[model samples]
Target: MSELNVVSISAAKLPAGPFIARHLIDGDWRQSADGASFERVSPSHGSVVTLAARGGLRDVDAALFAARQAFDKGRWSRTSGKERATYLLKIADLIDRERDRIALMETLESGKPISQAKAEIEGAADLWRYAASLARTMHGESHNSLGEDILGLVLKEPAGVVAIITPWNFPFLIVSQKLPFALAAGCTAVVKPSEMTPATTVILGELLVEAGIPAGVVNIVLGYGDPVGAAMTADKRVEMVTFTGSTAVGKAIVKAASGTLKKVSLELGGKNPQVIFPDADMTSAVDAVVFGVYFNAGECCNSSSRIIVHEDIAEEFVARTVDLSRKVPFGDPLDPSTQVGAIITPEHQAKIHTHVRNAANSGASVRLGGGPLDVPGLNGQFYQPTVVCDVRSDMPIARDEVFGPVLSVLTFRTLEEAVDLVNGTDYGLSAGVWSENVHTCLEFARRARAGTVWTNTWMDGFAELPFGGMRESGQGRELGRYGLEEFLEAKTVTMRIGRTRTPWVA
Candidate 1:
């Protein structure tokens, strides 16, 4: 990884002109109704990135009204699935064309490595293409049973205007997970991206317009959760709400949407566990664990922050993990070689340090990093990759979601104990098992309560696979056919050809 300590001033240049960050409503860019705006600072150096319009109730109302009108009156909702697919394909092409620009914007805003940011951009494009394929192939069911006397048809129809709120960690990718499928299902939407990383999402608005999406089919509103996001949840015009963020906020959304009973899909926080058995390949397990926790600085919802190792291999695994964790390069996000970049914000960095301090006080050994790095020429939020050992499952550090580059290690002697440790947390988002024994790996995969389990690997995902959580981690799934179903409401139609009246009806 590149060891460059400072953001490349030359490479990190922003788009020219007085960029007026505004809300995209009804195919036009407009300032927030309240005339409020916020400065987006680069996480790598705490410098001003751009001024983004701070949306509120008025902006939310306008976006939602446009989405509702587009769904209820525009041709987008009535267009054939093939026609929708064509637009989505064009959008995918546009994303690929603008990959570098979007990736740079994402890196500057979120402080993730440029390499990872580019991968996310490519992944987002693939998702749009995948969703496009699903759009054309989406089909309803027809039942011709009942001796030809009755015809039953099951149809999948759009759920109307949807509200999508995405987090900052994987800004474009997370939104791609929900938005493309919603569009493929013939639904109009209003997207509220995280305030920290709203630039890329805003650019997406321009891309949609270029791709020929209808005037009001897709809208972008920038702001925080309150007043803007809350307005979207409470608005009766929005039929469905899909969010990717914290469990606390997800709960609040669920409560707010209860009044209208909107279809809600949430991908929330996780305290995921990675299990390493004695028989597992030490080299592979160590590398996978490192990538699992430290990738994106562990801001990912499915980050395997907890490492549960077999007692026999605990010492070696933790040692190797610590050594590898220490080697993770921390520097400029724009540097192509940097493996670890700055934290999203100073507050988040402080929270990570606090978690490490508490863990140390609670008797967990700090095996690797426990504080922030002071790289020259870089005055931003950078936290060292941390590894905590000798942690009990009951410890707060082991149970809570740190959302940083902090890994907590626990040891178990038996398979049953390992399974219990993995499933002990309230989160059931994702988990990983490393073992050479097929039965052992399969057993752990079966017993683990997570929605997605990795055997002999970690943090692997595909556009075609369904991704989400069970229990408190959140409801519903994203990607694949299941994702399309999330934005569709099923309708059943039955026709009686025999002209016979049912007794109950009479």
Candidate 2:
């Protein structure tokens, strides 16, 4: 047996060490009232890296109470957009300053390659900066509908205290995606990060405090979704709930927030499709499909898991894709040369393995890498870049969100069939189309059900563009001005001027 690579981490610096990191209720890290703690599993090696306190309903109450106090005080909300933008912009700068440390920690905790982690880290910092820039341009509507003297002015205000629940995949990036915008909109928030990956969020809480995000303005509570998430979602004091996770959980969020009719935004799971046509540059198409599906170890929700190739080019594309899939190097997340890292955990690894096995048993032909990988000198949670052909659209592996390095290739006889197959799912988060034809490009881009449609590209995202889904994929939106609006509510200030004008009513 060979020795597995081990990395040590501590909380003294920017990169966090394993600890009983607790809730930031009223801007302080305090242990949970119940004293319950959960193991912080490092997906890189499928081991407990550290212990973190699990929050109960009481912690939720405390966090929400602090948020309410901050919101009611109207300090953040009353601040001009220009002033709020400064704080957000400062946070952006701090993220860049500590980018390397945060990226390293992210790679270790999330089992993502160093390169990918760095890219995500950079992207998140850009989001804060982007949100800051967007905040300045926010304007109100001035309509003189009633009369010239009676101007019907409409203003956008912060949605009060917000409950932001993020997923485990891109913890810091997703949190940055929401928080800067919420702060830009002048809202205080209680952030509940996924228990599996709470380190980055905890580290970010410290950074937020340093950036002068006032106490109660930004808080993090680590816990399971049930009591912590349930309490926040159902609380009447919370004006908005922004969540990113599975569709099943998004439904629960909707149900929980229904009582208070709070504003909500969800960015959920995806089985996004990539349609490859005969006209596409086969070399680029093959490379894009391989990277699209296997990048980040196939953990991204925006990943194009379904490769819908035209019958004319299906075999060739699959052959080239299979050839390239084998080239993706999988190993330690810290290795700079490594391309793919481990699957998130043992349970997720087994889930992916089971889906692959089920698909193979059900008659789908497995072409390349279909099982867990054993890298030399590394006992990490790794999986080979899998490619499956002869897959029917109805197969479980084809329809479900395995969230691992598994790709399914299906043939489409026509453009209509390609579109149909791409949209034939409960998800509509994103899709990709590769073709040289202008008409075909425009057609699919227009009709694809996903919130994001990329032509001749895959998984290229920016903060200026909205990322979300249709159907059960999610509700509301994120990024861009639409994302900023998600944290705001519009109120029409209608005043009665020249009352004598409506003498008949009097």
Candidate 3:
């Protein structure tokens, strides 16, 4: 085994017992109606990290009813821009104050590095602040040129109650992406964090309460998808459902919401690619490849798991990536120095390994780490930073989302071929090009079938730029003015001044 493949597990403090968590419904902390609950085991430490209320149909019903009542009462939805902005800003400040506490719980539940968890928590606060800015600046439109004495008004109104279903990988950040924007748009919401990682979101609910948000504006229910998420999607009281998870589950949510014809916004899976040209900055490109694939243990939907490189430079680039992959620390998440932490579950770790084993069997070369890494003093699941070369376009590892610390290397001879390869997957979440040539970068950016295209960059995001996917990746955008618009409904009003409207009766 390469020395860089595994890192020595250092001693770290563990929580004495699982933290007790509860649901936030109608601005009150509550337990499951049946007193049922579930435990979330730390993927890095193999110990129970959280014991949370397992919501049932009754809990989901109550939460949805609360959200609908809140929206109908117009406590939040009818508030002025300034009033809403005030609440959002206060929530942002609370998030900053509780950052460390939230980050620690998030790191425990999500199995990501402590450093990454802290950064995500801090980044989530920025998202809330940005949403506050949007709340204050949201507006409608007026058309005075419609006709003489006739005024046309375009009004933006809240979309009523929304169901926000977030995944385990990015509990805090994803909720911040959806909820604050929904709130900024004056919409009430019922949020469902994944059962595996529900602690931080519950913490966010605590912050919302501390920020003095009105009751029923935001509610949270914790449990599995069957009861909690299904109830949220199928509830007629909810006007919209915004979800971030796998494409398969996204399809299910869409189908369920279709019964009520509820508006839906989904941020689903990705097999994102980063294409490199021989004329590109090789050093920068190699480093990005390593960072992109290994970041968050490749569990992120935007992970650049595959790279289509120029045939001429493929050999050297793959070798450099392999070398860097070995150097990334992999061990317990609590160890702040560990760059890549444990897998979310043993099954997921096994699935990641299956993908690699199958790819190797199909003739792809496992150039470096390709199996599980045993971390000392940690009994949790962890996969090695893996690199596979000789990847064919038709291979499963090249097309499917093997979300792990694994990189698949594909080679191309022409820009057209590179673009084709980038667009080959069923996912169109994100794609990138690394080249010094402006023409190549511009052409690729235009031709790539992705929601966000990064030229000479990978996974750099902002609150200003809208993010989502095209095709099966997802529908509807998130983050930006567009994100707020997703939770709004537009209405047109026509008024006649001075009784200048003509009567049609003859």
Give the winner by lDDT: 3
Runs in model 2 deviating more than 4 A are: 1-20, 504-506
lDDT of each model, Cα atoms only?
A: 0.89, 0.84, 0.92
**Residue 74 displacement (Å), model 2:** 1.0
Cα displacement (angstroms), candidate 2, residue 478, comes to: 0.4
- Candidate 3 residue lDDT tens string, 1-506: 65675655667777888888999999899999999999999998888999999999999999988998888888998899899989988998898899888988988998999889999988999999999999999999999997789899999999999999999999999999999999999999999999999999999999899889999999999999998999899988989999999999999999999999999999999999999999999989998889999999999999999999999999899888887777888887877798898899999999999999999999999998899988878889989899999999999999999999999999999988998899998999999999898998999999999999998878898999999999999999999999999999999998888976568995
Candidate 2 to truth, TM = 0.95
Once model 2 is optimally superposed onto the true structure by TM-score, how far is the C-alpha of residue 231 displaced, in angstroms?
Answer: 1.1
User: Which scores higher on lDDT, 2 or 3?
Assistant: 3
Cα lDDT tens digits, model 2, 1-506, are 01222222212222345645677888788899988998877676555565788999889988888889888898688888798889888888888888887777677678887788888888998999999987898887988767665768899988899999998889889998899999888899999998888877887887888877778877788899988999999999899999999989999999999999998899999999999888998898899988888888888898888899999988878888887776666787777777788788788899989999999999998888888778655546777778888999999888999888889989988899999999898899999999999899999999999899999988888888988999989989899999999988899997767653555755
* lDDT of candidate 1 over 167-285, digit per residue (tens): 99999999999999999999999999999999899989989999889899999999999888999998899999999999999999999999999999999999999888889999999
The best candidate in terms of TM-score? 3
Ranking by TM-score: 3, 1, 2
* Candidate with the larger TM-score of 1 and 2: 1
- Best-to-worst order by lDDT is 3, 1, 2
RMSD of 1: 2.2
Least accurate stretch of 10 residues (summed lDDT) in model 2? 1-10
RMSD for each of the candidates: 2.2, 3.3, 0.9
Give the TM-score of each candidate: 0.96, 0.95, 0.99
